[model samples]
Each structure stands twice: as structure tokens, then as C-alpha cells.
Target: MVGKFTVVDGHVHTFASEEVSGKILTSFNKLYNIEFANPGTGTITDVLQNMDSVGIDFTIMANFAPAKIIHKNNSWSIEVGKKYEKLVPLVSFHPDMEEPMDILMEEYMRNGAKGIKFHPMAQGFDPDDNRLESVYKMSAEAAFPIVFHCGRVSNARLNNYADIDMIVPVIKKYPNIPFVLTHMADGNIGDVFKLADMFENVYFDTSIVITGYPPLLKVNEPSWPDNEVVEYVISKVGADRVIFGSDYPWGSPGHDLNRFMEMRIEDRQKSMILGENAIKIFKIKSSI
Candidate 1:
């Protein structure tokens, strides 16, 4: 895999149908005024083919949906994981969902769910809400990693929901559970370092921040980090705590992996960020 290195995309979004995937892309395009990259239509078939193209041995499914349909979305994710060994599913949770957190956790964990994904902005819940205490407790007890869509989202109005300060309490309360702040905390480099320094269990995922969506290159907005910035983050956070993620359907796995592989970091560091750290953090049984 990738010439002596096992590669795992630690963060990816998948949809059960292309219609849903297209709607998501459309929404993002409208919100950001940019045509986000669509590497594989967010379907399992497309994701598998994209992974094969880049030698991505495994990918953590970090799909999230509206509260009304979260159960169905997560159920699809779990079933997909069972059917496809290479796809590891992380179920989603929203405090507003009718089903209690305990019931959802029991069902999801029993059905082979690897972890949890929380998009506070998309799910419309504050990360530090009192309602999420049980979620944190269960995750800590089970040592299940929780991936958060940290930093700004396309809708600036909802950015406050995922602010780094909002999740600090939960991170402090559950020191044992792994908390992966995706998008390199959305390029909040100082805050990223502060969290990494303070909490040993806190990790970062390099998704859109490592290599910006290709389509956005012509846009005036700041997108991804330069090579120097990427290397600086790796040095500051250590490769052991940074994981590779394509943010597929929005960012291409092939392009992101190529950009990542070209970084000046050492081979061991690359190996760790590309796959080893993911296996250790997610408890993925590597077939590579």
C-alpha cells in the first residue's frame, strides 16, 4: 500500500444513495459559492473505487445527517460496515433525536459501530450541552473515539456551534476517550497546538486543511496550508496524533494522498499519519 506504507483515510462521508449525496454537494456549493470537488458521489461503490485508485487500505465512515433521519443514516452506515470490511462506520448522535442516547449507543455498539461522529453545526446541538453527558460517559467507558467537525462550516452563522471552546469541557471531562478534531481544527493552528499540548487524547485529522479542494484554488478565500505549514503542524502535533483524512466527495482521496505523500516529513512520520495512527486510534484491524 503506497509503497511500504499502509494508508487509511481516517475521515470520510458516505451516503446510501446518490440523490442524498448530490443534495449535500449542492448545498455546500450554494453555501460556499464554490463547486466543491466530488471524487466519488459519496456512495460506497464510488468510495471503494476511489480508495483503490489511491491505495487507501481503510477509511473511517464519518457520515452525519439531520436529527430527523439520523437513525436511518447511522443504520445504513453500520450495515455498510458489516458488508464492506474496508469501511469502518462511525455512527452519529444528536441530542434532539427521539431515541435516547443510551438506547442508540447500545444498538450502535452492538451492531459493530467503530465510533461516533458529531457535527454540532449540522446536527444543531452544542457540543458542551448537558444533554451530551451520557454520550461522553458511554464513549469513555467504551473507549470509543468521537470525531468532531471542528471549526467553521460553510454557514458562518452556525460556526459557534463547533467552536473549539465549546468542546473543551467534554474533552476535559472525558480524558480517556479519543477526540479527533477534523480539518486541523479548521486551520486554527494556535488552538490546535494548545489542545494537543493539554490533552494527550486529543488528535487532529488533516482533511480539507492539508490540501484544499481543487476547485477552490481559483477562489479568493484561503483554502489549504502550504507545504511549510503542513510540516509545521506535523512537527508541532507529532505524526502520532495526526491522521490522514480525505473528506471524500468534498476533497479527493487521490489528490490529498499525493499531496500528503509529497510532504518533507520523514517516512516513519508519514507511515504513522497515513495509517498506523489510525489503526491504533480507531482499533481498526489492518488487512494491509
Candidate 2:
């Protein structure tokens, strides 16, 4: 724990192998025209080591891959969570996959999946697609929390797939399922506030937006929220609805944690954002 706080990283990505991690990083470099720092290859071992370095007690594995390989990636994520006590796995699913939703959910739940991770932009599906109604219905019945990559990626070919509007319907329909929108819904902070005001089950994870993108030298201008902006957001939404996430590999856990700890907020709010809120929202049972 980080001095009286359990410090759970609400969002992180893990890869099956170092090669895949390297490739993903390379793609990001090409897209952003900047070299990312050595964030330890995005492997399970790398993630655990980073967590230990930063005093993060738990990390939710928010891994996602192309639809063709999603099942395999999710299976690996589940196995990793099963083997590591501190790693909480949130598997990904696409409605276009050949496997039926019921069968896939059964397999994922039977194998110890903690929740679901959806990246409509990465997986190339619309969040409000009619095809996903079954997925949402089943998730509601099972009460699975879904962590969404709810903002646009830098230099992405398309951005509408995960837009706030695209996700609003599902969030409204599945009130039983906790929906954690990552990156403070990135470019949609206004809508994010509206959603937080409207739905008690909606949550916002402070990932890249809270600390800005990593390796400060690469950024042309300060694109993230300032201390005042962040404080205002927390105050408006209430500390209970904000979660701490490092967006590991793309962002540093150590740097992000230190920055957050230094924010001009009360110890009570810091404690909530750092870990307490995530634990309650994700339904984590580990003793903090």
C-alpha cells in the first residue's frame, strides 16, 4: 500500500508476449510520431514489477486485441488473473465473433473473469449496435462491470465508435452493470459530467487525462487537465465516482501515482480516488 492507501490501478493493459507488446508500441509510435519510453514491454511480469515499484496493490488487466484474436487474448488474460493474486482480469468480447454470447460468457465466468473490457474503436464495432443488446442483457443479468475505452485515440482512423453518444444507450439500458469510462471520456468531459450527474452506476477512471500522456518531451502542448480542472471534476462528480488508472505502458504508474498524490485535494478524496472507489466499483474482495 502507498502510505495508508491500497493503491489499486483501475486500468492497465497486458499482452501475451513481449513481441506483441513491442509491435503495439511500434504502432503507437508511428501514429503519434513520438517514441514512447521503455514501460517494460507490457508483459505480465513487467506489469507486476511496475506495480511493485509503485506500491500498487492491484491492477485490472484491461487488455484488448483484434476481433480475430480476441478470444485467445481474453483466455490468456483470465489465466493470468487466476495465477496472480493481484492481477484482476477484465476480458474483451466482440459481437461479431463466431462464438455465441452465452457460451463465451459461460467460459469466461467459469474461468474466473472478473469483468469485461470493451474498446469499440480498437475492436471496430459500434457501442450502440443492436447486435450488442444480447451482450448487455447478459452482462446486466450477471452484473459484470464493463470498463470501456470511452475516448478517441490519438491519430485514430475513426473516432465515433466509442463516442459518448454511442455508449449512452447501453449505459442507460444496463443500469445494473457498473460502467467505468476510461480517460475521463477523453475529449468529452462535458458529456462525462452530464452522465455522472444522471447515472449513479456510471464511473470515470482518471488515466491519461489525469496525468497527461507519458514522456513529457513528446507532447507538443499540455493537452491534459490542469490541477484546478481535475479538482473541479472530482468536486463536481464527487470523489466516489472518480477512479485512479495509470494506462500503463502508455503512461507510467509511478509518475501518475506521484502526481495524483500531490493533487490539491483532501486525504479523504485522495484515498478514495487512489483505490477505495475502484475496489467498491469493481467488487474486488482482496484485503487492502
Candidate 3:
């Protein structure tokens, strides 16, 4: 875990709200007053410090900008990107906004955004909706990967296959846009594997899926072992398409770091899970 080999957390969040003032963990912990100081969310400094402690090199962090704050958050992320080399800023779109697809292509793409993060459940839109087709097309044109929040598999709040199936035609239509399905496409991972096989532009990141519990505690059962799930994803999608993601803030970074250390995956596979896969997928050249 020393030398140039360490974990790279791909998905992280910064609560850059006026209420929190971008102090990630401290503000959240203060709000909750938890003694452990390990509630997933952390300030940028906290995140960086935790990474150093755990041998994590970088964390690709993103912030949410609803319609009103979209411009400001985007600006803040750009400035934050300038300040923190380890924090790779990501752009997000809430389909509810006016002409969000057009805005993403024309304005935000020109900004320092490396990718697009969409949450259908939070945003209240179907991935397969005809309106989002234009947005997907714009992503293809921009060559920016779309990191989507895939819903659950069974008795889930969002139907996994149904939500993603809506976008199958888009994958077929835009064969070159790099689309990354996070969290192993919720629970219906087999269907996500099919998408990866069917679409050359698609990739899936192994995030909170490998981590044991929390938020998805009821969902992440004992039967779903980390080694088994990671092995299955690598087998189906190949090592290259599978990238590492801690899902920090919302996900348990410390617990996941421990689990990753404990997992039986080989050193080479672990390297792929940590950072190598992301290098290939995101075309990120230099190490952090």
C-alpha cells in the first residue's frame, strides 16, 4: 500500500452549501454531534487527511447544484479544483431544470467538469425518457462520461433494469459516449453486465457495492460478499471496465478502506480496483 500504489476514491461529495460553508465532515458531524467523527461526509481537508491516513491518493469529488445554485456550485467546484489537486470536480444535472441538456453541452462542458452525475430518483426522471435522449446525445458529442445512480433490483425504490433499460436505445444510438454505471447497477448486476458487453462506450465502477453496509444496510446482506461481487464484476465486464469508487460522504470511506484491505482479491486486481481502471476509463493521465 506504499509507493505509488494506493486507492483512488472515484465518487465523493462536498457539502458546499452556504449552511456548511464547504467544511464537509465538521459541519455534518457538528450538525449530528457524533463522537466517532466517521460519518462518511468530511470537509475537503478531512477528506484529504483521511486519504493520507488510509493510503488513498485521490478522491474524485462532486457537488450538487440544483437549478438555482447550479451556476454557483459549478463556479465553486472550478475554484476548488484550482485549490485541490486531488479533488477532481464533476458536473451534475437535474433534468428538472430548464433546457438542462442544452446547458450541459454549451456551458458546463466548457468548464472544468470531468464527468456528469445524474440521480434519477433524486431528480425525479426516467433514464429512458425521450427528453433525456438529447442530453445523452450531448454527452456523446462531448465525450464526457455520464455517471448515473442505478436503482435497486428487488422491492427497490427505483426499478434497476426498468430504469436502465430505458437508456439501452441511447447506448445503442450513441456508441462512443463513455457511460459509467455506478454501484454495480444497483442489484441487477447481470443486466448491467449485459449493457457493458453490448456497449463499448459503457463502463461500471465498483463503489459502495463492495463496502459492507450503511444506507444500503438492509440491501447489503451477508450473502453479498465483497470478493464474490468484485470477482463477478471483473469476470463479466473484464478488469479494464471495472474501476474503484469509495462513494465517500454518502458511503463509509473508512469501513470500505478496511474492507478493501481485507478482501482476498489479488494485488493486480486490487490495483485495477484502486486506480488503474479509472486511469484508462477517465483518460486521467497523471497520478495525484
Candidate 4:
């Protein structure tokens, strides 16, 4: 365990090849000039090694659909997750794709995918579009969590769609589905944290929280996140709703955990943020 806490990174991605230009690797290059030789060190094998070194027990192998490769990427995640018991694969699809609800239903029945992730800006859709109703309802029925890219990034064209305001209505509509707002709203974190206070099912992930934010945050230029904002959010939403996530390969999970651990809070709270919250939300079974 990482300093007496059983660790789990709730948000991480897999790259079958360095040529696959998804945000998982692109963000790393854009934020830091460090390059991978290929997917050799960023694929499932790489994740396993990193977890072993840093004391991470398991990770959720998240997915993001990049329009052209929706099916191939989803299948890759499912198959990789099967290869390793530590990786929990998430089903993903573009909201605007044809018959996505049917696809998700079939994938779940066939593969037993328990959770899903979405990148609204990457997929080119409104975050709260009505077209997602059937899929959201299906996930709600299963009590599956939906991890949404609720913040802007360097590669996205329309930055406005990931705003928390646009998706609050949708979050309200689906109470059963544990809706996780990723990247702490990507710098609009304070506002996003307030939303957590309003919804019981709402949760927040500290993935890129340690790195750069818009208007000036950079991966090469590291900045300590505002402790005041974090303390305030924890006070407002309580530590139970916050989960630890290292946008693996893009940022360090250990760094993210250390950021929270350095905060002046009770140890119990830190433990929840590190792993308990994710285990409870994702229903992660003990890998030990």
C-alpha cells in the first residue's frame, strides 16, 4: 500500500500503440515533452508495472471514443481488462453514434461492463443532449457510474460543452447512476465542487488536479493546487464524495494522492479519497 493506504486509480487509459493519438498520450506530450517509445510502456503491461512500483492495487481502464475508432477501442478495453484481473474496463461510445443504446446494452450483456466514460467535446455533442436518454436510463437501472469529461482540454474544439452547468440537469434526472465529474471541471473545479454538495449521486475525481489548468496551467510547469479551494470543497461536499484518480500516463496518481495527503485533514478522510470512495462507488472487489 502507498503509505498505509490501499490505493486505486479510478481514471486511467490504455494505448495499444503510441500512434493511437487519443488524449491519454496526447495530453502527456502537450503537457510534457516526454514521449513513449510506443504503447510498450503505456499499454496494459505498462500500467501493471507502474502499479507494482507505486503500490497501486488496481485501476479502472477508462475509455474515450474518438469518433473513427469507437468499436475497436471499446473492444480493446474489454479485452485488456480480461487479460488482467487488476484492470476494470469501462464501456464507451459516442452519444451521437447510431443505436448507441443498443450497442451499450449488448456490450453489457455480452461482456458485463459495469461502468462507462464519455468525452463530450471529443465526441462533438452537447453534454446534456436528450439523445443520451436511453443509455443513461439503462445505466441508471444497472446502477452503473458514468464518468464524463466535464472540463476542457488542449485538443478539444468546443470548450463550453464540458461545463458543469450544462450537465447539472442531466445529473439531476438520473439519481441512480453515480455521475463522476472528471478533472475537477478542469480548473472550474470550485464550481464543480459546489454541485457535489447539491447531488447525492454526484462525485468528483482528482485526476489532473495537480497539473496545469486553463489560462496558464502547464504539465511542464507544475503548480501546487490551491489548498484553500480543496479544503473548502472538502468542507462543503465532505471527503466521502471525492475519489482519487491519477490520469495515468498523463499525470501521476502518487502525486495526486500526495497532494491530498499533505492537506490538513483527518487520516480517515485521506483514506477515503485515496481508495475507499472509488471502491464504494465502483463496487470494486478486493483484489488481494
Candidate 5:
């Protein structure tokens, strides 16, 4: 209803169990208490309906389920992919686990995970720390890209968390691996712009920035509006270096998909932000 082009929401999470109550609040203070024992809200049907209603053609859905939690829920993400052709699964792994890298590759990835996710803030690790090198190496070897959580930690204190500096070295060392920085690095726009200029394998997702972050960070700013941040990053990294992200369910409580589409951008640029750019970089098929 908003635009003719097919859209790709690069980020969304599914809860594992519907029985145990876990509260997740957006930066805006909107809270969603998830029951781990029950069925997930972002089921295959729910994803299809939401995408169809929003005019989105495809989505890269991600999830994190610890062993203590309903670890089996992680499989549901792959299930969503099976149930809906448009859904692509991004799998998660726990860092504290030993050689978890091998497990991810042998099990989740071989099964059909399109990408991997790293929650430095929530997952409790620094993206740049040497400890994650194994994880990065595995992802690189698999030729799959990784999405990282970047920005201020509202949920937890991650040692050396939320900075491109921590992860930049890894990106530099493993030039072949693709790193996707989510939340625009959580206001690390300048560093992100630099990385786009520096590495061909690095990418940034534009999600929830317009609302989750303060006005100063908006890419569509009037003078050098927040959109300038978007334009600058695009200029430095090239349009392909940037991908569209909603930070959905969390960022969605305040920002709507239509407003995200309506931002100040040229038609072609909008097309890239919506879905085209991601298709090229991730090698994902476009519904268009």
C-alpha cells in the first residue's frame, strides 16, 4: 500500500517458549512480555500476513535461544523459512560455549541458515574481542554474513560493547567475511561511514534510527538531517553497503514501515534501501 517495490525487513526476533514470561522493552519504553512456553507471535503465518499487509516481499528473520531457554525455539526460525518461501533464517550461537562455531556450522548452518546473528549487548560479548574470532572465522568460511548489535546497552553491560572500533580489527583481519552492523552501530554513523569506505565486506543496516535514536541522529534531518547520515554512509560505502532494517517489533512500536518508506530519498535510492541493495550483497533472491 505504501510503495510498489518489494521490501526486506532485515531484522526481527521470535521468542522460544510461550510459557515462561520474559519482558522485552523497546528503547521507547514499550514492553512486550514474551511467554516462552507458548507459540511464537512471529509464526510463518504471522510473518506472511505482516509482510503482505505492509507490501514487503521478503524478510531475513533472526532469533537467539539459549540452552536454558527453550533452545528448540531456534529451530522454529528455520521452520518459518520452510513454511514461507520468502523468509530467510539467520541463526544465533552462544559465545560462552566451547567451539560452538563447529556446532553452528555442522547443525544449524548445514540445515539451511542463510546468515548468523551476534548480540554483543544482549549476548554478552564484545564484537571485537579475540574470543569471537573463532565465531567470525566460521562465518567467514561458511561464506555467510554476520549481523552484530551495536550501540548503547540499555539491557545489559557488555564488556567493550557497541563500538565499531572493537569489531573493525576483525573486519580488517578477515577481509573476506561480511559484517552487518545493526542499529547503525547505535549512533556510530561516522565510524560506519568510515568502514563502508574501508571494507568491501562490511555493511550497515538502517533500522529504528529515526525513532529509537534521538532527533540528532535521524538520517533525514532538515539541514544535515538524519538522512544526511544515510546519504553520507551510502556515499562512502556505496548503496550496496547499506541494507534496510526495521529493528522491528522493538522499533516498530514507534516507527511504522510507511514512514520508513517516506523518508527523503530518490526513487532509485529508496529502492536500494527497501530491498534491491540487500539482494545484491547477500545474494538473496528478490521477489521483484
Candidate 6:
């Protein structure tokens, strides 16, 4: 535990330099206004370093794989997840990929994946695709939570795939599937709150919302989801459903933790957002 709280970073990405698509890299550049060499951003070693520094006890890490590279990315993620006790593996899948169902099943049933992650912007797909129905159904049956990249990228066109309107059917139909909306649906925070109100299984994470740079960098750029928005999300959704996530490299866990701590929320609420909610929702068997 991080002092008085059980800190869990509920969202994180781990990909080889080659696996990050140009589009995803470009989007990251736009969000942070920095020309990032995708590979320069920390790797497993960096992730561990940052988590240790920030007092993050655990982190839920996922792989972002497109249709053509799911196998490679998933295999790589399994290797990394197995090596780190603090890193909880959240596997990936592609609806168009051959044998995706089989891969998904094996990842969970054999590899011990704690959850699933879908990055429509990075992987190129729509969150509302009918093809995902079977996947959702399967997850619902297993009671496995899927944290989807909700909302659009900063300068990308595939954002429609994560549209809040499109999220309705997938979420409504699969009541049992715990859906953690990533990026707070991008900018559609209002609609996100509605979904949370409609479905108990719906959840939100604070990652790459305001800023991505660590407090040390102090990039001096405008924060996207500013304090007002953060306050609105917290007051409206309450703390139990808000998960702590730093889109590391893309966003800093250290900065994100500091930002959340500065908010005018209660300590108990902060504790839940830090980790307890994630543990309960994701069924993590962490001692914290």
C-alpha cells in the first residue's frame, strides 16, 4: 500500500517500440504537444521505475494490438506480465482477426489475464461494431471486465469507434460484462456519466484526461480535462467507480497521482479511486 492507500494504477499500456502504430504515436504527440520517439518512452523497466517512485503498488497493464498483430502483442504481454508481480496482465483481442475467440479464451483460461483491453483508436475498430457482440457475450459469461478505449483520439478519425452513442448497445446488451470506459470517453464526459447511471457495471478511469506530463516536466501546456471537469466527474460519478489510471509515457502516473491528490475530494474517496474500486471491480487478489 502507498502509505494510507492501496494504490493501483488501473490503466496502462505496454508495447514494443515496433508495435505502436504511426497513428497511435501521432495521437500521443498531439495530446502532449511533444514530438515523442515512441520507443524513448519507458519500457517495462521504466514502468517499474515510475511505479516505484510514485508508490503505485500495482498496475493493470494492457497490450494494444491491431487485427494483424494481436498474436505478437499478446504473446509479448504475457511474457512481461509473467515477469512482474506488480504488473497485472490485461490481454487484447481483435474482432476481425482469425481465431480471436480462441485467443481470448486461452489468454484468460490459461495465461491468467485479469482483464481485456480494446483500443479502437490505436487498433483501428469501432467500439460499437456488431462483430464485438460475441466477444462481449463471452466476457459477460465469464464476468471478465473489458477496459475499452472510449472517446476519440486527439487528431484521429477512428474516434467514432469509441462514440458514446455507439457504446449503448454493447454495454446494455452485456449486463454482466464490467465495462471500464477509458479516457472518460475521451471528451464525452457527460454521456459517460449517463452510462454509469444506467449500468452498475460501467466504470471510468482517470488517465490522460488532463495532462500527460509528469509534474517535474511541467510542460506548460493546457490540460484537457481540467480541474472543473475532474470535479464534475468525481461529484457526479462518486469515487467508487472512478479508477486511478495514468496513461504512462503518454501520461504520467506520478503526475496523475499528484493531480488527483490535489483535488478537493475526501480522503476516503481518494483511497477508493487509488485502488480499492479497481480491486473490487477487476477481482484483483491483491493483499492491499
- Judging by TM-score against the true structure, name the best candidate: 1
lDDT score for residue 188 of model 4? 64
Candidate 6 lDDT over residue span 1-288, tens digit each:
566888998887765553454456666677635544432254677778778888999889866677877766777777777888788888777778876575466556477677889877667676767776777777888888999887654434544666666667788888998889877666466676777789998888877665545441343232354676777778898888888887766677776777777878889998999999888877777865
> After aligning candidate 6 to the native by TM-score, how far in Å is the CA of 257 from where it should be?
0.6
TM-score of each: 0.95, 0.93, 0.79, 0.84, 0.78, 0.85
What RMSD does each model have against the real structure?
A: 1.7, 2.0, 4.6, 3.9, 5.3, 3.5
lDDT of 4 by residue, 154-210 (tens): 433355676676778888899998988887666465576568767889888877664
Report lDDT (Cα) of residue 107, candidate 4: 72
Q: Scored by CA lDDT, what does every candidate get?
A: 0.84, 0.81, 0.64, 0.71, 0.61, 0.73
Which is the winner by lDDT between candidate 1 and candidate 2? Answer: 1
Clashing pairs for model 3 are 24-43, 25-42, 25-43
lDDT of 5 by residue, 228-254 (tens): 555555666666666777654444412
lDDT of 6 at 20: 53
- Give the range of the ten consecutive residues with the poorest summed lDDT in model 6: 214-223
Off by over 4 Å in 6: 17-40, 210-229
Model 5, C-alpha of 103: deviation from truth (Å): 3.8
1-288: candidate 3 lDDT, tens digit per residue: 434466677777775542464454554445433333244445667677777777776677656656666656666776777687777777766555665567655666565667777666545566666766676777777687777766542224533433676656656777777877777666466776688777777776666576654444444431245466766667667766766676666566666666666666667776777787666555555645
How many steric clashes between backbone atoms does each model show? 0, 0, 3, 2, 18, 1
Model 3 quality (TM-score): 0.79
Off by over 4 Å in 4: 21-41, 154-157, 211-224
Q: Which candidate is the best by lDDT?
A: 1
Query: What lDDT is obtained when candidate 4 is compared to the true structure?
Result: 0.71
Model 5 has an lDDT value of 0.61
Task: Estimate the lDDT of model 1.
Answer: 0.84
